[model samples]
Target: MSNTSRDAVLARIRQGLAAGPAPLPPRPDFAAPVHPPLNNPDIVVAFAESFQRVGGEFYYCESLEQLAVQLAAFQERQQVGPPYVWESDLQAVLQAAGIEFLADEADFIANADLSLTSCEALVARTGSVLVSAATESGRRLSIYPDQHLVLARPSQVVAEIGDALRVMQERYGAQQLPSMVSLTTGPSRTADIEKTLVLGAHGPRRIALFLLEEEENNG
Candidate 1:
């Protein structure tokens, strides 16, 4: 086409576009649903039921000494020498009780029979334990071992995932957030092979939680 004809066509197209309907108004943001705060009993019950449904074992310990006794009994039944533990108060307790724990040896850790680690928070809504690379367990300790044991206090339990995340945020400020966060619900399982359910397909076959409850001081 000639230059004059092309310019006339472009002008007509622009004029037609300008005469079209105005753009639609922006949609209003939806209001979020409100939920009431959950009581401690409700949260604990929810966590227990959810965890059990997903093939997790739960134990209630009155104190660290009781936890140690239960752990010792478990170790004897499993016939394992010592578990791989992170640097924490639990380790000290075990040591004091003459229960050995392997140091941070990467090679040995992968082959260890069990791993004991501390979690940042427990989500009652999902029955999940929140962990992070910032903790002593890191990543491999929770995943590589054949069995996993978690030591959590009653105070660490939260009503939902949001509360658990908030705990992490407050513990480690925005600038010092951990490299990774893991929310583990239960023992690893898979139904990928011919729809046959198999446990420990990718991770530990067993997971046990020892919930330590301390007495409140009346004073």
Candidate 2:
């Protein structure tokens, strides 16, 4: 570079350095919600509507008996074989209802047609289910198989993601948060191939959630 050009560049550099650093941004209000407010009066209803809109099957069961009936009908309608269930509580309930499932690990690995498990919480606004490593369902049951089923109660429904997060915080203290926390809003889908949307490209093609109302006696 010529001496005159070098001097000009050096002068601009010095001028820029003369100005002080930019002011720091204002601190955010962590207590206040950052996203759009979720104003649903009934989170369970909101969750069910949103979940179905996202191509998920939602069953609102007033009792365990109703859940069993609805689930059996769903299975028959879909023509899917026995589901893979691992949770002891879910297994017991299904067993009592005469609903058959494959609980063997080898069977799951060999034939993972559908998986049934419990979730931590359900987000109403986005119709997402929050699962953590703390929950047994957070394992392969949530992501593997062609279809995924979740069993939860109305008490676990929250108005929004933030509310669901607070529920988790209360469930597992800060120091003991799960290693893997995920929110599943719908079935796995991608539009990467020829810009045409494809379901179950990488994960379950179908998703189902059963919300069982808490029994009055239990509450």
Candidate 3:
């Protein structure tokens, strides 16, 4: 409270600092993984389990036809208007399947209900999808819609989050990294309201991932 007492406190603090900085706390092994391996062997299975546990819909498509059928059913069941798709790759698949989509930049969000987008990679360990602003899907198309439908191949699935980051770097490292690189684990949810859980409070109410098998692409 007194100036003298304050000066003494400051002097003591300076003396302690002069003695040398306090030893740092024991540091963790930076090289080691923060999380243990899932050890599930089947990365795809690991992904499905973690994803569904958090209210994500996991669909395994043996063939493109099956993917189309399931996607159409999801569209019809939810009664969401035509999905918004931007990427040419996804557009080709949709066209082949005869699934109509809204890709016009001006009208894409006019009546958006379902958003079908491609992802960078799938993190099997965390059930997360790595998305970026660099792609045609951009950002809002995946988050603003009532339902988000990700179209990915099994080959894109990786063992951990680090692997997903690696993929992001490898793809866009030459160019500046995308303005946004997001790892979305599941549908948006919040329990901040009196501890009562609510889904889709901020984003999509439903999140579905369809992993098309590699062989299907050969055919």
Candidate 4:
């Protein structure tokens, strides 16, 4: 009886297939509207506002020299000693400014008062910094430190997440993607304990972004 029922079901399926392909529904018209690309000035403003709203601090530096000055001030204010840093152009700047940084070692991240690293891209729409395992900082450096400082250039800022992903794809290609990617919007926080909000519960209590803007030449 089971065999007979199976045969009947198969026969019905075959009959339906023999009836030719079913007609597809008509495609919708009404062309989707396209949003204009955000200008650099607007993108900068939006990113700063969004980032600050989430308890993050934003600083604008006109050049590498300005960045160095800001970092010196920040280090003094936070009283951080030998911040943890990965290999990047910022290292030279930090060194020139006499700002000592711990060697890029996993074990030193927890003891360091602050961690400094470069980000992949800055999302203007959400004010998130995208980082990947391919970077020297790896996956643990950003979260383990008490304070996180990101060094980003103005050219790295994008309008949205899709734009940031596209930048990554263009930079590394799809075939050779990083092991992991993280989009951090702000310092870690939680309200799980008795509904009282707390910062640094899971990660850094303070997150600061320093954006370096280069002066363009008309000549």
Candidate 5:
């Protein structure tokens, strides 16, 4: 074959090799059950247990006030210095506990040692904090800080992943929704080296959850 033809043949072979196999579509997330776990004792226990299995601490309180108090105490014990953050009404909760609310600015997340966020829904089964982008304050405060404190009510606790999706749909219409919806299960953790669990490798090392009983009343 002439030099030009030989080059063309090699190019064709290269193209064939590069073609390879078609890309596979990503696996879809498994959907949770559609039914809510409201007033279900058995479901509640199971949900709480699952959270514990995932290295999360769960608590049931009489009221949101008590939960807030517990959170304050926990913060003190954990040595989480603040400049704490509350989305809106969370200010009242933290203020009552004497934790100052840091103002939101460019340096807000970088400067603050801890953050307190009140979320709309909690997936108890997964111990995930559901944060919609619609709540700008909550989203920023939760992810940016070194330690995240989430206040969730039992009423706000949904049974499974599907239930959370329903709540999100209700909060933000099907068409229009915030760009980010984070299902944060726990503090950022990794076991990169010799398989030893290392906390805070990616983000916050500590995540304290306050399962406020009366979410509406607290707000």
Candidate 6:
């Protein structure tokens, strides 16, 4: 074998070793409202607004398509920017929403690219979005970029952390799970130095939640 062939084989072996722990089953999509109702919209609004209160900006949209629009616009406003990768599922929705997809990759790379994605339920109790590494859509789009935007319907929001975990176990079996599952609550925050809560400490400085309402339950 050539030197390049030996190098390729070695790289693949190292990659496998670093994959870490048993894999969780694929991220499962549960059939529940993406955004559950709160006794007061104030509670939900407050949860969303808390990000801004701490210096991070939050934008809530009615649908994924609206999110795509706002996401693209946000990139345009930034002095320094995160790469924009739109989820392909979102692309179809964007087109229908009247936003055109640019032909040039440069255009997207220039102003917010998008990655098509699907996510498990968002937990209502803590406003944390559950993501499993086992799913491609679940991984890169949320973490790689400097800013993260999650589009979930009210139907996918579950009530608590345990509920989200239960759903994961059901799909992947107990033995097979990702090395790490991230439960992100708002943006990264810390109050270490002077005990002043600071936002965007470890992750994106912005987060937007779109509570898409369904007709069946206005109750």
Q: Which candidate is the best by lDDT?
A: 3
Shift of residue 149 alpha carbon in model 5, Å: 0.4
By TM-score: ranked, best first = 3, 2, 4, 1, 5, 6
Over 4 Å off, model 6:
1-83, 98-118, 213-219
RMSD of each: 8.4, 6.0, 6.9, 8.9, 10.4, 19.6
| Model 4 lDDT per residue over 1-219, tens place | 699999999999999999999999998665853554544467878788878877888999876567777888898898877678876776776775566777767568347678888889999877899989888888877888899999887788888899999999999999888988889989899999999999999988999998877435101
> Where is model 5 more than 4 Å wrong at Cα?
1-42, 96-99, 104-110, 215-219
TM-score of each: 0.75, 0.79, 0.80, 0.76, 0.70, 0.55
Clashes of 2: 0
**Candidates 3 and 4: which is better by TM-score?**
3
Query: Which scores better on TM-score, 1 or 2?
Result: 2
lDDT of 3 by residue, 77-196 (tens): 887767889899899887876778887766555677788899999888888988888889898988898889998888898999888888888888847799988888899889999999
Clash pairs detected, candidate 1: none
Q: After superposition, how far is residue 5 of candidate 6 from its true place, in Å?
A: 93
Model 5, 1-219: lDDT tens per residue?
999999999999999889997789997767964555544366556656766667666666566467656766776887865645546677776666555567466477457677777776777667677876676464567776778777666677777877888888887888876788888787788898999999878767777677665645645
User: Between which residue pairs do clashes occur in model 2?
Assistant: none
lDDT at position 176, candidate 6: 87
Worst 10 residues of 2 by lDDT: 210-219
- Model 4 ranges with Cα > 4 A deviation: 1-41, 96-98, 104-110, 215-219
What local distance difference test score does each model get? 0.80, 0.84, 0.85, 0.82, 0.70, 0.59
* lDDT-based ranking: 3, 2, 4, 1, 5, 6
Worst 10 residues of 3 by lDDT: 104-113
Alpha carbon RMSD to native, model 1:
8.4
RMSD of 6: 19.6
Q: Can you give the lDDT of residue 42 in candidate 5?
A: 64
Minimum summed lDDT over a 10-residue window in model 4 is located at: 32-41
